[model samples]
Target: MGNGLIYVMAVNIVIWIGIAFYLFSLDRKIKKLEREMNDPSH
Candidate 1:
């Protein structure tokens, strides 16, 4: 039973980590777009 609990926790942690990474990447892309929009050279 304890092993099962640990597995569930691990899976949850992995999912959250993945989501965090995805959000970080999205934020970076958005920032890049904003920079381009503000610059006339782009």
Candidate 2:
């Protein structure tokens, strides 16, 4: 039972990390688009 709990926790951590990474990437993309939109030359 202890091992099972540890495994579950590890999986949860991995999932959370993946979610964070995805959000970070999305945020970066949005910032880039915003910069382009704000530029006078665009």
Candidate 3:
């Protein structure tokens, strides 16, 4: 039972880390697009 709990915790941690990275990258992309839209040369 203890080992199972550890596995669950590890999985959850990994999932959260992945989600955080995905959000970070997504934010960067959105910001870049916004910059492009605001430029007159674009």
> For model 3, how does the per-residue alpha-carbon lDDT over 12-34 read when each residue is reduced to its tens digit?
99999999999999999999999
In model 3, which regions exceed 4 Å deviation?
none
CA lDDT of 38 in candidate 3? 96
lDDT of each: 0.96, 0.95, 0.95
| Highest TM-score model number | 1
Which candidate has the top score in lDDT? 1
lDDT of 2 at 20: 100
Comparison by TM-score, 1 against 3, better one: 1
Candidate 1 lDDT over 1-42, as tens digits, reads 687999999999999999999999999999999999999698
Q: What's model 2's lDDT at 26?
A: 100
Instruction: Give per-residue lDDT, candidate 3, residue 41.
Output: 90
Clashes of each: 0, 0, 0
lDDT of 2: 0.95
Please provide, for model 2 over 1-42, each residue's C-alpha lDDT reduced to its tens digit, 9 standing for 90 to 100. Answer: 686899999999999999999999999999999999899587
